[model samples]
Each structure stands twice: as C-alpha cells, then as structure tokens.
Target: MDFKLSEEQQMLQDTAARLVRDAYGFEQRESYRRTKLGYGADFWAQLGELGLTGVPLPEAYGGFGGSGVDSMLVMTELGRGLCLEPYLQSVVYAGGLLAQLGDDAQKDRLLPAVASAQLQLAVAFEEPQSHYHLNDVQTRAEAVNGGWRLSGRKVAVIGGHSAGLVLVSARVSGGERDEDGIGLFLVDPQQAGVRRRVYPTVDGFKGCELFLDGAFVDAGSVLGEPGKAFAALRYQQGRAIAAQCAEAVGAMEATCDLTLDYLKTRKQFGVAIGSFQVLQHRMVDMRSELDQATSMAMLAACAADQPDSDERSRTLAAAKFIVTRAGRYIAEQSIQLHGGIGLTDEYAGSHYAKHLVMISHQFGDDDHHLQAYSRLMEVC
Candidate 1:
C-alpha cells in the first residue's frame, strides 16, 4: 500500500501543523483550557476558516467533500497540538452521523451551520452502565401526544457541555440492551427538561453528564428510519474509532519526537543523555512503535470503507488493538525518558502523554478491542 501523503492531504496536514506551532502552543492551550467553554472562540473560528470543520462533510452542505483519509490528516495535526476544541465531537462524532443518517431537510438546515462552526453537536449515547457496549440503551423515548418524550442520563458526553444540538439514542421499542429497538433523535440543548453538568476530561478537554427528564421532540426530529438507527450508529462509530486511532498515532509520534529532542539536549554525566546506548535504544523503540501505530491507523481508515461488514469489523478491531497498545507504550516511554519535566503542567510532553493515554480508554480500551479482534478472527 502507498503510505505517502497526497498533495492535498499534505497541505491540510501542513496548514494545521503551522497553525498549532504558531498559535496553539502550550501557553495558549493553558489559557484555552481555563475558559468556561474549555476552549477559545477565536481558535474555533480559525479552524473553521482553515476549512477543517468542513473537511469530512459533503460540499453540498458547505463542506469540502473530504474523505476519511483527508479528515485523518486534519485529526493527526489536531492531536499533535493537543487541541481542546470540540471538533472531534462536533465534526467526527456528530457531523459524520448527520451526514449519514440525516434527512435532506435536516442536512440542508443544519450541516451548513455545522461546517462553519456556527453549531456544535454531541451524541448522548453512553449511559452510566453502558461501558463500551453499543447495544445498551437505557435511555427511553416514548411516544407522546404529538411527538416523543425522552428521559435518561448520559455520562461523560464529550462536547455535551457546549453543544448546540444533541443526538440522543433511546430505546424506542424492545428491551434496554436490545440492539433492534434503538432510535436516534436530534434534540435542542436548551429544551425544557435537559440539563448538562459540564466538566473537563482528564486531558483538559470538555466533557459533560447530561440528564434528560421527559425531554420532548417532535416527529420531525427523528433522524433517518425510526427503530433502525443501529447501522448508522455503528457506521459513525467505526469512522470515529478510525479517526481517534489516527489522533493517537499523531500524539505518539509527537511524544516520541519530544522525548528524542529532550534526550539530546538534556545532559547527564557531563554529556547528552542521547549519547548513552540505553536511552538511545529506548528512543529507537519509541520511533518503531510510532511507525507501527501509524500503519494501523491508516489501515483502519481504509477499512472504514470496505464493502464487507465482517471485513470492516475485523480490520477495525485489529487496528484499534495495535494503535491503543502502541499509543500507551509511546506515551509511557516519552514521560519516562523526559524525567521530571515530562509531568509538569507547563510542558507539552505531559499533555501529549495524557491525551494519548486517555485515548486508549476512549471508544474502546485495549482489552475490549483485543477480545473483539479475537472473536472476529474466530468467525473468519
């Protein structure tokens, strides 16, 4: 497979890298994180101006019609910067869902705003007990006089704190854990019975726990086919997992670069620590791990478009396992090699390390994906 970045992809990557290097340095990130929104308004506008917010959506909706790989290039740079913006929740997680499942009217109405960063969205899918189980939907949406009444709690919702819209998954029919009864609805965050308890993630990104007490939605709010949203959910999640793996690869590579630089500049025994064989060996391993992880990230993005469902699942699970494991290793080694400075709040390395580590636990952890891969392999 050709691994070289295409010209457009390279341009996207370079533009983002330059923006982060020039404007989103460690000091800027610190200030951005301290805001009530956990990010800067101007920063988000800048990203939108750069065409990143629209990269993955259709041009009909004011996007650039970029594919998964093109979006991956943008994500890699965002990860390298340890961005605090809600682009992942807004674009990858929510915008992708809208692109796939939204009706023409809905897409025409909202996707343009989304692409321009005028609106942000978060999916309220995970319940407290959901863990990584996609089928577990305790949130219930019951038919009402003219629409639906939704009630449930969604925890650790990645961008829910500041979302203009929320895509809620609720059980419209069968039992709580049944996969067939799922329905997804677009809800207004400012609705009567919706509440959000916003907080920062371990890596200083925005997160929230949302409570919906009989939140009302009209029939028009239903996205795609009712009680038939599982396929769309799975498809969006597969894309999200692939995007995250790309981010992890970028984070790990950035961490490895930082570590290698630190080793060369920081002296020990009156000489550069990089001169020592042991530290040099560790740096070598870090680089190799990063390369392996990058390959898997690319593979995952490719597999997202595979025609066969089983092939896609098996390939995704396998790629996720490799990327998560490599991410963890790269994160830990970078910190260890940097000594005390690596953990300091002011250092970029610590944030990168935290982000990479936190990513392993997102979407699905190492054990979850490993077991999934094993099961898929068994069936194959």
Candidate 2:
C-alpha cells in the first residue's frame, strides 16, 4: 500500500525525463520519423548501453535484474518524451516472453543480443480476423519435415519490419479461435516465405503486416509447451499492456502540463487565459484525469507481476480500461483547450494526442478491456 517512490526509482525517472528533454525532443522525433527505421538508431543504442533496455531483465541474461516496476518507470518516461523508438516491442513484448518461457539455451542466445541492442525483436500474434484475444489466434503452424510450417497472415505487427527475430503465435490444429493447441515459436525474419510489409502508424511508429507462407521453423524453435503457451503469452501481454498504460499516463501528464503552461502565457481578451475560471476548470479536469490514469497504471503494473492468474487478468483489464478511457478524454480536452493551433503538427499537443490515440487502441482498447473485465468478474 506504500505509494511513495524509492530514491532509486526517483533517480531513474529524473534521468529518463532529462534524457527525453535533452535528446528526444520534438524536432528530433520529427527528424527520425522520416528515416527508414522511423526511429533513432543511435538513441536506442545509447539506451541499451545505459542499461535502460535491460532494466527488467534477469542478471543472468546481462540485465539489471530489476522487477516489472522498473520497466514501467522507464516506459512512462519514454511516453513523456513522445519517443518514436520501439522500446516496448523489444523489451516488453519480446523480452518478457523470452525471459518467462524460453529455455536457458534460448536465453543465452537471445537475451545478450537484446540487452546489447545488437538484435531487435517483434511479436506476431494478431490476425486479420482474430481480434484482440491473445488466444484468439488463427495462424497455423502445421508439423512438417521434422519441424513446423507456418502459414498465416498477421496484421499490425509493431516493429516487425526491422526485427531480427519474430516470436509468432500460431494455432497447431486448424480451427477458429480457441485457447487449446496454440503454440509460440521464434522465426527468423530472413527465412524464405516470411514477408513483412512495413507501414507508418498514427503515432510515428512502424507496424507491419506479416505474410508467412510455408515458413519453416525447427522443433527447437518453439518457445514453450504447445498447448500451454496461451497463459504465458497472456501474462507477457498483460505486462506489456501495463507498460503501455504507464506510457499513456506519461503522455497525459505531459499534455496537461503543456496545456497549463500554454494557458498561463496565452492571452485572450488582453489577459492570460489561465486566469479565466472556465479555462481553469478545464485544466483542473485534465489534471484529475491524468492523476486517475497514473494511479490505474500503477495498479496495473503491480497486477501484471502478480502470481495469481485470475487476479492479474481482472486487475489488468480494469486498469487498462480505466486508463484508456480517462487518457483519451484528457488528450482530447488538451487539444481542444489549446485552440486551433493544437491540431497542427507544429504543436506538441498533436503528437501527444496521436500517441494517446495509438495507446488507447494498442493491446486492447477501452471496449476490449471492459469486456475482459466483465468476463473475469463473472468467472470470479
């Protein structure tokens, strides 16, 4: 129940905030958006070198051996900076899964590269029809030639185009959405029949649609037990969503601060707009929502690392749903309060707004999470 941040956590937050302000500012983000990578390679390298990428990883894997809270803190700062780098993809999605389920051999081979930023990863789970359920995957991984032949289409795969490896979720037995018989496998992007078409998302990040036709993976490539992969993947996804919720909270915080600062200086009727009661009320409302989102983010992060599966699902869903709804409202209010200039690209509001929009939809939207919450509540 203690809510205070430790000194180390405070230092990490300060460091991240400073780094974003000094290096990952608006102009830098704009410049990097046009690059083929759609992000700063050097900045990512620096983060890796600084051990930020390995903060939540195990010490045995060349990481800092920190807990999930550490990763949440870092991602929160990344969001505050409006960072375009795919830190979530490499760390939360790929690394979390690998650490939790991959064997020691897999860890020895992949964790070092990930820790050093020498290799990047992306998770391929979504399908054209499979919706947001982690176990709703329809991609098939049929046994073939002493291995598996994967053939399916995954859409909206973040960072897939540039990933050195892709951890894919496929259905072993051909059928519609079901939790049973699902499998997770590591696939090399250079393999034949694995195609990635990269595209830009609204938040200035790269997402790709993967077409795997007869893509082969050795038996050793499976990350975990075939029929039991869903729980592990879902756990990793909850953690990933928790990180994103924290990130959204960060963006909302920045949005509120930016709006408040603008109100203080912006003149209307020959006076500071902030002095107006109506404007002050709007700012107060934004701050309230931001605070709620932050609280929910912390709850979700804690729940994500919990040992109880049922509790983790419920807490995560509730937290995600609450944060998504509140964060969206705050971002929209920020843009509206900023007036016509807010919608323009030059203004920082637009960037934060776009990121908020993307975050709201990622992993699960408000509606998705709400349904999950309902289902969990009914079961419990």
Candidate 3:
C-alpha cells in the first residue's frame, strides 16, 4: 500500500496542525484545563468552524464522510498539542457508533448537531469490575411500559460530565460477562434518577462517574436492537484504539523532538551532552521507537475502516500493544534524559510524557492487548 498522503489529506493535516499550534500553547492549555469544562470551549468551536469535527461523520449530516486515515491526520495534531478536547470520544467513537447503529430518526436528530459541534456525546461502557472487557456489562436495563429502566454505575466516563448525551451499555438478558444481551442506550445526564460525579483525570482531562437508579429512556432512545449491540461496541472501540494509537505517535514525536533539542543544548563539562556517544545512542533509540510506533499507527488506522473481521481485530490488538509499549518507553526515556526539569508541570516535555503514559491506560494497557492478540492467534 502507498504510504504517501493525498493532496487533500496533506492539506487537512496542515490545517489541523496550524490550528493546534496557534491555540494550544502550553500556557493556554493549562488555563483551559483549569476551566470547569476542562478545555477551551472556543477551541472546540474552532474545530467545528474548520470542519475538523465532522471529518468522520456522514455527508448527509454536514460531515465530510472521511475515512480513518483522515481522522489520524487530525488526531496526531491534537496529540502533538496535548489537547484535552474529547474529539476521540465525541467524534470518532460515539459518532461512529451512532452512524453505524442508530435508527434513521436518531441519526437525523443527533448526527447533524454532532457534526456541527452543537452537541457533544460521551459513551459509558466500563464498570468498576469490567477491566477492559467490552462484553462484561453489569448494568441492567428492564423493559418498561414506555421505555427501559436502567440501574447501575458506570466508571471513568470521559467527557460524560459535559456531554449532552451519554451512550450507556446495559445488560438486557444474559450474564454479566456474556457477549450477548448487551444494549446501548442514549441517556440524558440531567434527567431524574441519574447522578454524575465529575473529576479531573491525571492526563488533564475531565471525566465522570455515572450512577443510575431507575433511569428511564423511551423506546426510541435505544441504538440498534436492545440485546445486540456488543458487536458494534467492539467494532467502534477498535476504531477508537486506532485513533488513540495515532495520538500516541504524535505525543511520542513531540517528546522525541523535545528530548533531542534538550540534548543538543544542555551542557555537561563544557560541552553539549548530545555530543556524548551514549546520549546520542539513547536519542537514536527514542527515534527508532517513534518510527516503529508511527508505522503501527498507520496500520491500525487502515485496519480501522475495513470491514470487521478476525484479521482486523488481530491487527488492531497488535498495533495498540506495540504503540502502548513504545509510548511508555519514549515517555520514560524523555523524562530521564531531561532530568528533574522533565517532571516539572511548566515544561511541555513533561506534559507530553504524562500524556504518553496515560494513553496506555485508556482503552487497554499493553498486557490487555497482548492477551487479546494471543486469543486471536489461537483462533486463527
């Protein structure tokens, strides 16, 4: 496959990079993080104005209907900026799920708003005990006269605190860990019987814990069939993982750049440390890891848009595993090379290091994906 980006893709990447560079300086990012929303509302609006928010949605909803590679271009810029926006949750993951599984009416109502950034969405799929297993849903949904009544707790719902709508996974029939009987429900955060406790994540983003006690949603609020959303959930997660890998690659790139610059300037015994062979070798190793991660991210992005299959699943698992490991290694090496300054909050390299470390814990860690790849290999 050709690795060269098309003209349009290059332009898209440039646009995203410019926007991020201008609006997301390190000081500006810290100010945004202090806000109640945990990010700059204006920057999000800028994304919509630039049409970046709609890159992956359908054309009918005012989106560009771009592919996963298109998303990778935008996400890399966001990652390089260490942006705190919820593009991965709202646009790529939740929007993809809505487009894939929502009924016509649901799409007509939500997709356009989402594409325009007039509405933000969050997905709540993890429970306290699920441990990265998408099929392990304990939240229960009982069919009611006009809708479904849901009761359970969802943990670490990124962007859920501010989202207008949250898509929750609930078990409609089978056991907690069963693959079947899973349903995705659209929930209003402000409605009765729902409670949200918001907190700032270590990575400088905000997320919430959702407690549902008989939360009610009308029949129309369910996405796809009630007891059959596991496949779509898993598929969309694969796409998110691909985007996340791209983001990690971007962070790794930034970290590597910062470390290289530091090595060339920081002096030890009257000469630049970069002139030392040992330090030069370490910098070279960091660059090598970044290159490997970039290749795997490209593979993951390509696989994300393909038709779902064992091959797709296996590829994504491997890509995520490799990217996570590479990100951690880069983060540690950058910090070690930067010395005490690398751990300072005021330094951009330190923030990039934190972002890289946090990326590993997001969807699944290295071990989780490694086990998943192993399972797929056995099946193959």
Candidate 4:
C-alpha cells in the first residue's frame, strides 16, 4: 500500500506543525499548564479559527469531514509539542461519539459548537471498578417524569473540570457487566447534583473525578436509544485509540531526536558522547523502535475511519499494543541517554518522556491491548 501523504494532508500537517512550533515553546507550555483550564485557551481558539478542530467531524455540522488520517496528522503535531489541549477528548472522542449516536436534532445543536471549539466536552465512562472494561458499567440511570436521573461516580474524567458538557455512560438495564444495558447521556456540568473534584495528573495535565447524585436530564440529552449505546462507545473508543497511537509515535520521534542531539553535543572523555560505539548502538535501537511505532500508527490511522468490524478491532488492538511498548522503550531510553538532566522538569526531553509514558495508560495500556489482541485472535 502507498504511504505518502496527499498534498492536502501534507498541508494540514505543516499547518499544525507551524502553529505548534511558533506558539508552544517549553516556557509557554508551562505557563499554559498553570492556567485555570490547564492549557492555552488562546491556542485552542486558534485551532478553531484555523479549522483544525473540525478535521474529523462531519461536514454538515461545520466540520471538514476529513478522515482519520487527517486527525492523525494534527495529533502528531500536538504530541510533538506536548500540547495539553483537550483535542482528543473534546474533538475526536466526544465529537465522533456525538456524530455517530446523536439524533438529528442533537447533532444539529451540539456538533457545530464542538467543531468550532466554542464548547468543550469530556467523556465519563470509566468507573473505579471498571478497569478499562467498556461494558462493565455500574452507574445507574433511572427513568423519571419524562426524563432520566443518573447517580454514580466517574473517575479520571479527563478534562471534565472545565467541560461545558460531559458524556456519561450508565447502566439503564441488565446486570452491571452486561453489554446490552449501557446508555450514553449528555449532561451539563453545572446542573444540580453534579460535582467535580479536579486535580493535576502526573504528566502535567489535569483531570477530574465526576460525582453525579441523581443528576437529571431531559429525554433530549440521551444519545440514541437508551441502553443501546455500548456498541457506539466501543467503536468511538477504537478511533480514539488510533489517534492516541499516532500521538505516541510523534512523542517517540521527538524523544529520539532529543537523545540523538544530546549525544552529539554532550562531551564525554574529551569527545562527543555520540562518538562512542555503545551509545551509538543504543541510539540505533531507539530509532528502530520509533520506525516500528510509526508503521503501526499509520496502520491504525488507516483503519480508524473504516466501518466497524472484527478486523478493524483486531488491527486497533494490535496497533495500540505495539505503540505502547515502543513508546515506553523510547521514553526510558531517551531519559537514560540524557542522564541527570533528562529528569529535570526544565528540560523538554523530560516532559516528552513523561508524555510518552502517560500515553500508554490512556484508553488502555500495553498489557491490556495485548490481551485484547489475543482474544480477537481466538475469535478469528
């Protein structure tokens, strides 16, 4: 298969890269991290103005209607800059879910704002006990007076603290672990009975624990049929995983570049450390891992926009597994090559390492995807 980017894709990639290069310097990133929203609001608005926020959404709703490859190009640039915006959460994951599962009225109302970045969204599917199992929903949703009441807790809701709306998954019927009973609801964060406890994440980002105490929502807030949203949730999560793999590839590439540069400039034994044969071999290994990660990321991006199928699921799981492992290796190796300086927060390499390591934990980690891939193999 051909791998070269189309002219349009290259232009999108360059646009994202240029924006990141000009605006996301390390000190600037740190300042953004210190903001109330934990990212640069102006930078996010710039993304909207430039149409980057709409890259993967439907065109009918103020989007570009681009494919998953388009999203991959943008995400790679964001990862290279260690950007802390909620593009993955608000645009790719929540936006795709809305496009797939929302009714005509819901789509017409919400997607345009999301595409324009006028409204930020967060997803609350993970429970403390779910452990990455999309079907293991325990939060309860009950019908009441032509509406619904949700009561449960959602943990690690990334970007939840600042989101205007949060897409929450709850069980409306069947057993807690049953796949047939899950429902997705669009909830206003400021509504009665909703509470959020925000905190900083290990990788310098922020997230929140969402508490819903009988939060009420009208019928219009439900996405698709109640208790029928599990499939869509899983499918959109696969798309997010694909984008995440691409981001990891970008972080890995940045880490490799930093290590190689350090070796060339840092002196050891009256010469550049890069002149040593041992370190040179390690650098070669890091590059090999990056190359492998790049291939898997490309495979994931190609498959992410395709119709849902067993093949697509299997490919995504495999891609995520490979990329997670490669990212971990690259992160560790980059830090080691940089020695003590790499661990300092002031250095870009350290931040890249942290971001690379954290990428594994999102969606699912290496071991989780490995098991998922194994199960799919058995099904095949």
Q: What lDDT is reached at residue 253 by model 4? A: 83
Q: What TM-scores do the predictions have? A: 0.97, 0.97, 0.99, 0.99
- Ten consecutive residues with minimal summed lDDT in candidate 2? 173-182
Give one digit per residue, the lDDT tens place, for model 3 in 1-380.
Answer: 79999999999999999999999999999999999999989999999999999999999988999999999999999999999999999999999999999999999999999998999999999999999999999999999999999999999999998999999999999998999999999999999999999999887899999999999999999999999999999999999999999999989998998999999899999999999999989999999999999999999999999999999999999999999999999999999999999999889988888888889998999999999999999988
For each candidate, the alpha-carbon lDDT, in order, equals: 0.87, 0.87, 0.95, 0.93
TM-score: model 1 vs. ground truth: 0.97
- Give the C-alpha lDDT of model 3: 0.95
Clashes of 3: 0
Alpha-carbon deviation at 111 in model 2, angstroms: 0.7
Error of 3 at 312 (Å): 0.2
lDDT of 4 at 44: 94
For model 3, state the Cα shift of residue 308 in Å.
1.0
Candidate 2: global Cα-lDDT? 0.87
Q: Is candidate 1 or candidate 3 better by lDDT?
A: 3
Task: Give the clashing pairs for model 4.
Answer: none
Order of quality (lDDT): 3, 4, 1, 2
Residue pairs with colliding backbones in model 3 are none
